[model samples]
Target: MTIAVRTFSQLNEAASAIASDRDAAFFGGGTLIMRGINEGHAHISAIVRTTDAEFRAIRTAGSNFEIGAGATMSDVLANRELSFLHEAARAVGGPAIRNMATVGGNLFARSPYGDFTAALLALDARVAAAGSSGGRETPLADLLRDRERNGHGVISHVSVPRPAGGAEMRFVKVSRVKPKGVSVITIAAYLPLSGSRVQGARIAYGAMAPTPVRVAAVEQALEGKTLDASGVAQALAVATDGTSPASDPIASEWYRREVAPVHLKRLLLGQPA
Candidate 1:
């Protein structure tokens, strides 16, 4: 299939034109799009570039942090204000791939193994989109659900609240090589502590499920608990329970199940996985 490329000087115009054509798509850094075209996974007549969109700025919008759709992973990593996102950005592809993968592209790609989505989930991020109906905000989880349910539209930005209280976070990915190996399991944890007790806890697991999911049961069980070895063990148990991980050439379900609990325990206790 042949794909035609187009450029836009403004986002409103781009959104209007793409909405007029059902098969049209917006291009970002083109890392995923180019690969999909090469692999026969994506075929479309037209591609619209986001270079002219005002979606490249990373700034505070009210109390929430907004990241422009066109912002590259490299840009996010270099921003001192986006420390959590920076950590996640560093875990994306290597130098060249990182330079080419954009935040909006990664979120829309909807790959279950994508590190950025998992990190966003951990941050409780929301996606801002501009479509034929104009613009709106949707929770990241809901957006992923909609993308899976109905493939359409362009993501204009992503917003996340500056976490309140004493927030500590950790990300762990198990792979043979940092850059290319499919992660056996990726875990992201965020803990907001009060005194010696945990005021809030969020744990998200990726590559071990169909999508990045919050370990709600585990999070609830750990909330208000003293951050200790015993609590960590229990949280890990709940976190790994009922996971539906698929076996692939690189790893097995048994291996993921085995590693998940142990890693979760380590992360909750502020120890490295």
Candidate 2:
């Protein structure tokens, strides 16, 4: 079906208007919109654009960094103040996609291969949205868990707390070479060490299950342990427990399951598992 598109100068007004329009939807950079339309996944009748909204600022508010939902991946990468998200944004699809894909769209779509989720989850991000219900903030993980919870509202901004406790954060994505391969598995680790023993460890893996799963078992194994070969193997084993993966055209479940833990161990401990 053909989708008629319209642009609005303000975000809240446009998003709220679309909520009642019945046939209208909000459009950001049109990167995902056009792709979905071409792939026959989206069949909307109209689009309300947020191009003109003053919703692309990246700044600090209170204790967190406020990231405009409309901000592009490139926008995040280019802003030195948002250095934490730079690697994740660079890991996204290629340059053109980085220039076009919006942070709000990536989080809202909840694609398993999305790089930002693992990063944001590690960062303990919070989402601020505005809609018919007024406005509120929710944990990013909870918002992602319930995509339909938000009405036709705009994710006005996201708040990410500054990294604490001298934690070392790492994000790893293993894909075949190119712009095409979906993630075999993605891992994000936040490790805080106290004199060679792990004081805290938070490890989250993506594309290894229906949704991103935090490897609490692995985290527990790594916590309070020195980063050694023995500890790494235990952590790797914990990371793969209770997981039931399925084969797809992109990758075999066996390959994903095997490679994921190996990558996780390497990323965290900096050696072969």
- Best model per TM-score: 1
Give model 2's TM-score versus the native structure: 0.89
lDDT of each: 0.77, 0.75
Weakest 10 consecutive residues of candidate 1 by summed lDDT: 144-153
Name the 10 consecutive residues with the lowest summed lDDT in model 2.
Answer: 128-137
What's the distance in Å from true for residue 54, model 2?
A: 3.6
Give the local distance difference test score of model 1: 0.77
Residue pairs clashing in model 2 are: none
lDDT of 2 at 228: 81
lDDT of 1 by residue, 156-209 (tens): 889988877578777887777756666788888788888877877777778777
Which residue segments of model 1 deviate by more than 4 Å?
110-112, 131-135
State the lDDT at 174 in candidate 1.
Answer: 71
Deviation of model 1 at 237, angstroms: 1.4
